[model samples]
Target: MHVLLISQYFLPETGGTTNRVASLAKGLQSKGHDVVVITAKPSHPEGVIWEGYQDDGLVRDEQEGIPTVHTWVYADFEKTLFTRLCSYLSFMCSSVLGAVRERGSFDVILAFSPPLFVGLAGWITARLLNAEFVFDVRDLWPDLAVAMNELNGPVKIGLARWLEHFLYHRADAITAATDGFCESITSITGPDTPVQRVMNGTEPEVFRRDEAGKKLRKEGGFDDRFVVTYAGNIGICQGLDHILEAADRLAEDRSGVLFRFVGSGPVKDDLQREAKRRGLDNVEFHPRVSLDEAAAHMAAADALLVPLADHEIYRSFIPSKLFDSMAAGRPVLLSVDGEARSILEDAEAGRYYPAEDGQELASNIRWMLDHPEACTEMGENGRNYARTHCTREAQAERMTAFLEELIG
Candidate 1:
């Protein structure tokens, strides 16, 4: 099968969407499928073109034998409404043009979303090429933006909502990354639309527990501390203020607890300011690290933190960090509600607190700190569970089977 994948973010961009799409592409290639990824130059979270890469409209590269096509997009790391819109629109135009110029016969076109405009491009290309187009809904788009108050003006929000509907209805098959998203899309687009819940998973080899990482942690002053690390985007969706509050509550327990936030996003500045204002000496902030570095950090931590804002849209969402933490044999400290919490409890991977409940989160943190042995046990359980359920091999097999059915 010849597959064309369209996404704004890709390899070297340290986000869930990038990792998932890369893994899927590689997996498909390994299974004898010819996969071509059409993506923008590496720029996300910190929306700047990666060093050594030029934004010259389009460039083609090969990673692990998969052909990847990168296109130029206007993006700056600044987190303003106007800039984000420009970034999305730029990618939409560039990707459509790039896809058209490439002109390769494809069995199917898969478009991943957040900036749902990519789906629009896939729809247009599929129409032109007479190929099946699958829209991979990673998040419920404009509705999620609306929920976060990111789309402030009423008119803009309305237009975005309309576009969102248009994309959903136009797709051949919709693949949602979460069950909640699948249900929501089904409700909105009707049961007739093919929607499958293909979750975000980790590549086991890349994210397993590492003794070297543990040694690095000890050398880096993490020997005595019970580290609770949040190793992903620090965006608005992640209500990190609650984590700061938890740090404040555990400040007096100097010997036992430490909070490490090892990522960057729009909320990083505000989180740092809040931590300083609260005099959270227990908390430490680190810049976003590469995939290997992040894996090492996760392996070193006693527990991983997954915090989501108290919003209806987030209930169905499971942050990819949770899966990485589980793969690293690190117990999770989840402050997310809904389907995500359900997954943790079913696996017995970690303890959960209500979203935005600082006191409850602090109490859970203290409990984990006191019960080191229990934490270790939970970590082991999580690793075992992840090996079976959330590994790349498992997810890829499922995705390949879905594609095969579509092609047949």
Candidate 2:
């Protein structure tokens, strides 16, 4: 089968969405399916485009040896609704043009969504090429926006919902990344549309514990302290201010535990300011790094932190970072509820603290510090569970079966 994978984010842009799509592309190619990708150049969490691909009309390239096309996007990282929509719409228009430029026919066009317009691009491309369309829902958009308070007023939200509904109904099949997403999509589309859960996973070989992280540990003077790290987009959804609160509490106790944040996002400056205001010296922030560097940082950590905003919509979110932490052979300091909590509990990889509860997070951190042997055992359990249940290779095979069924 020939596949065309469309996503706004891709390699050179480090994030969960990019990794998931890249993993899917590699998995499909390994199964002997011809795969291609259509994406924007590397610009994300930050609005600036990466250096090498700056001169762009429509750049053609090979990613992981898969034929790929890079289209133009209005790179805006601002929080305003208008700028955000402009970014999504620009990509939607350019991706369709990029698809037209490509030569071969596609059996399936798999599009990832969050900005939502990418699904429109894929649907348009599928119609033009006479191919089946598979809409991949990493998160429910307008609903999440509403829950996050990013979208308000009935008119704007109503229109977004209409667009989401149109895309779902047009798809030949809809694949959700979480079970909650599947149920929600099914509820919206009714029994007529097929909604399947594909899930997000990590590549264990890429994320496993390694000696390379010792460099970061030594350089950061973390060799003697217990380092708890959060490496990903430092965006609003992360609710990272709570981590600072926890750091402040630990500072009072002189717990010898360090909180590290390694990433960039819209809210990072605010978090930094808050930490400085609180005079929390135990917390440190680093700019984002390449995937290899990120894994190394994960390896250097005594425990990995996975946090989310306290809201109803987030209960369904199983952060890709959680899987990475598990694969890195590190115990997790989780601040989430529902589905993500279930994964941690089932794997016995970590302990959960209530979302936005800094006191509890600090208490959990202290517990880990006091019981080093238990933390080591928990880390081992997480690594073993990830190896057995959630490797990217297994996820790819599951996706292959879904796509093949859709094509048939």
lDDT of each: 0.84, 0.88
Clashing pairs in 1: none
What lDDT score goes with residue 201 in model 1? 85
Instruction: Tell me, by lDDT, which candidate is best.
Output: 2
lDDT, model 1, position 213: 69
State the TM-score for model 1.
0.96
Report lDDT (Cα) of residue 105, candidate 1.
89
Estimated TM-score for each candidate = 0.96, 0.97
lDDT of 1: 0.84
**How many residue pairs of model 1 clash at the backbone?**
0
Best by TM-score: 2
- The digit string of per-residue lDDT tens for model 2 on 239-351 reads 88889888989996756889889988889999999999999889899999988899999999999999998988899889988898999999998987889999999999999
Q: Report how far off residue 291 is in candidate 1 (Å).
A: 0.7
Q: What residue runs in model 2 are displaced by over 4 Å at the alpha carbon?
A: none
